[model samples]
Target: MRVGLFIPCYINAVFPQVGIASNKLLKSLGVDVDYPEDQTCCGQPMGNAGFENEAVSLAKRFDEKFKDYDYIVGPSASCVVFVRDNYGRLRIQPNHQCVSEGKIYEICEFIHDVVKPTHLKAKFPHKVSLQNSCHGVRLLHLSSCSEQNVPYFNKMRDLLTMVEGCEVAEPERPDECCGFGGMFSIEEKAVSVQMAHDKVQRHLATGAEYITGADSSCLMSQNGIIASEKLPLKTIHIVEILAAGL
Candidate 1:
């Protein structure tokens, strides 16, 4: 099946390698992948900033961009979830179905659920703490929420397990927010930094050399703290980790 690679604006600008790795990983799995170069933001930033009207045009543009693909996959869970949840509200088209009845999926979800590869050629010989971002855990159901008394299942961990020499661990509070709530980080700078600091400490306590997750925004938040304080930790996208040694 054909898959459209949807790279979010932040990822495209700040972390281009994640996009590259995602493409390579998908290709290595023998999946036909195409990246629409003209793609812009999924309008998540605008919608999260209390300026949703400004995001309507972007939603329309995004929907038009990848409408024909069999599946739209992206590395960021938040962006993918935003498109899935809000596209109907934007109603760019007449009686629009949001993301065409959820045609879009986070890369890990797509790989784990749809591609269902029994093996991978990737090799990352490092211990990594998995960051279950809010959108990934609560909304996308990538993993079981901690508050719920349900059987535990982690799609990110399941995918990473296929990689050789990769040790995946989780923080004590696995699904806590990293405080990069788009505009919330800026509006509540002090609170955001505090939350990030706490999150970083918890991640480090796992004795992982790197923090990896499906969402770069959370890793970006913790990376800021790790960098400023010179912590012996690094942030790498889960896509990068999975694409390693390919």
Candidate 2:
């Protein structure tokens, strides 16, 4: 199946390696993946910032860009889930069919559910605390939500386990939000900072050398705190870890 890679704006500007690793990982799995050069923001920022109308054109543009692909996969769960769940409400084109609505998926979700690879060539010898970004856990169901009584399953954790020498650990609060809710952090600065502080301390408590997750957005925010406090931790996207040594 043909796949289109959707790199979120923040990841493109900041953690470009994550996008590169995502492409490399998918290609190594023998998937036909292509990057749409003209693609831009998925409008998740504007939509989450209380400006849904501004995201309409972006939603339409995203739909047009990847409509032909069998699946549109991105590294960020929040952006993918936004398109999957909110595009229908954007009223773009025919309004009857949002081509990308059902096809878009977070990279980890696509790999775990669709590619179903049993092993990877990746090997990273380090302990990493898995950061279950809210969107990935709650919206995309990338992992079992702590608040729910579902059978425990963590797609990210499973993927990381494939990397030889890599040890995956979870913070005390496995699925807590890192307070990087797109615009939620900007609007609720105080609350967001406190939440991030709490989240980071828990990850540190796990004695992990690195904090890894499917969403780079959350990592970016936590990295800010780590940098400011000079904490003994680093943030790496799960794709980068899964693509290690490859």
Candidate 3:
């Protein structure tokens, strides 16, 4: 399993630890991992903002960077969604080849479905509210909602159950947007904050010590509001908890 790790721009800048943990976890499971320095943003931010034309160059760059890897695993679901969904629109010939040849996997999905760790050493006593990233839930369908009549899409829950003391809770309205839709946070600050506030309120009501999700952007959005309001909730990436051991 020659896996190339794709660290999103936000994770690369702010939560590099998540990327590190992901690499360590994968290697610990006996998979060969590689991080290509030439890789940068997956052009998700620009594509989400209707700037597909502007994103072409970045997409081309990313395509060339990791085209040979068997699988490109990313820590952020949104970034994976960006490449999985929009890489075909890059218009460049090599970009198309890259998308066709390389398999993109979000870290949780890879762990739950592909790697399937036999012995998880992670133990987290905190009850966690599962904040499903919009792209992962709505776009990539990484995990299924109970509202939907699907049976095979609960990979996130399956992985969480493997952790020793971790409990997963769903919000009042499962799969609601956390409002960190890339540039939406900047362009629609008021609405973005309100949505994040609502999400945090729901998480708080669950009485969870930590809110956890596969997407850091959604966690970051909720964490900011929780911090400003001085709430007792802390946000964590799912991998961070999974990497822990009691």
RMSD of each: 1.0, 0.9, 2.0
Report every candidate's CA lDDT.
0.91, 0.92, 0.82
Question: If the candidates were sorted by their lDDT against the true structure, best first, what order would they fall in?
Answer: 2, 1, 3
Local accuracy of candidate 2 as per-residue lDDT tens digits, 153-175? 99999999899999989999799
For candidate 1, the lDDT comes to 0.91
Per residue, candidate 3 scores C-alpha lDDT tens digits across 60-139 of 88877877788889898878877877777576574335552348889988887788886677788879988888778876
Across residues 131-190, which tens digit of lDDT does each residue of candidate 1 receive? 999999999999999899999999999999999999989999889898988888999999
Measured against the true structure, the TM-scores of the candidates, in listed sequence, are 0.97, 0.98, 0.92
Clashing pairs in 1: none
**Count of clashes in candidate 1:** 0
After TM-score superposition, what is the CA distance of residue 186 in candidate 3 from its true location, in Å?
2.0
The all-Cα superposition gives candidate 2 an RMSD in Å to the true structure of 0.9
lDDT of 3 at 86: 72
